[model samples]
Target: MNVAFFLIPKKDIVYLKEKSTMRQALERMEYHSYSAVPLIDNDGKYVGTITEGDLLWKLKNTPGLTFHNTEDIHLSEVEQHVQNLPVTIDAQIEDLISRAVVQNFVPVVDDQQTFIGIVRRREMIEYCSQLLLQRKVE
Candidate 1:
């Protein structure tokens, strides 16, 4: 029941660096077709999650801030609406499922708190569905 079993490795995930520009975050999110993405620090630790809402809010509140000129805004400066917090690598599936209840993916990190991968809600649903079906069959 290790969470790693459900992990979508970091290599396949589009994540934002703490120092990346708001423009970079937007481009990466658009490229990956994701509404939210995990933000990692320079040391590879999970900082927080950045969502489309966070971006829009920043635009609406910040003076003179527009999509056309996001180069001056750093990702770190944009207030993040953090979703599911990260789970350690050794965390169980039960823990993953609980967190996925609130977010699309549960960010997984190592003992050092370094970003590793994510367990998507789709995977959690499939696992629970299979479990439920097995009970019905029994």
Candidate 2:
């Protein structure tokens, strides 16, 4: 099956711009109640995934940095603790499943590495569950 079968299109997803501040990331994550969110470039390419842990580490490691000063910290300066590698839109279900094992959501990109959407783990589990049920019913 095509990877797009499990995609949650980018249009429906919340993402941060590459140049956005860490403060912006925190605010967006808070509003959406998501621990992690995808990072997109100015050209709309998938860059990486940023999580609450990354922010925490940044705050902990940066000397004299406070929440109030987060606005001055750009997303580019913060290292993503986890880089959930993106898969092409045409990737197979097997490939998606492998990546899903490590990521809550797998980033989906086009041939040119343009950000397109994501394949969530819950969706993959449900798809696998349905497949198994069908086999049993056969």
Judged by TM-score, which candidate is best? 2
**What TM-score does candidate 2 get on C-alpha atoms?**
0.97
Q: How many collisions per candidate?
A: 0, 0
lDDT tens readout by residue for model 1, 38-138: 99999999998999889999999999988888878888999976666999989999898888878999999998999999999999999999999999999
lDDT tens digits, residue span 58-84, model 2: 999999999999999999899998989
TM-scores for every predicted model: 0.95, 0.97
Alpha carbon deviation, residue 121, candidate 2 (Å) = 0.6
- State the displacement of the C-alpha of residue 105, model 1, in Å, after optimal TM-score superposition: 0.5
RMSD over all Cα atoms, model 2: 0.8
Model 2 poorest ten-residue lDDT run: 1-10
Error of 2 at 12 (Å): 0.7
Leading candidate by lDDT:
2
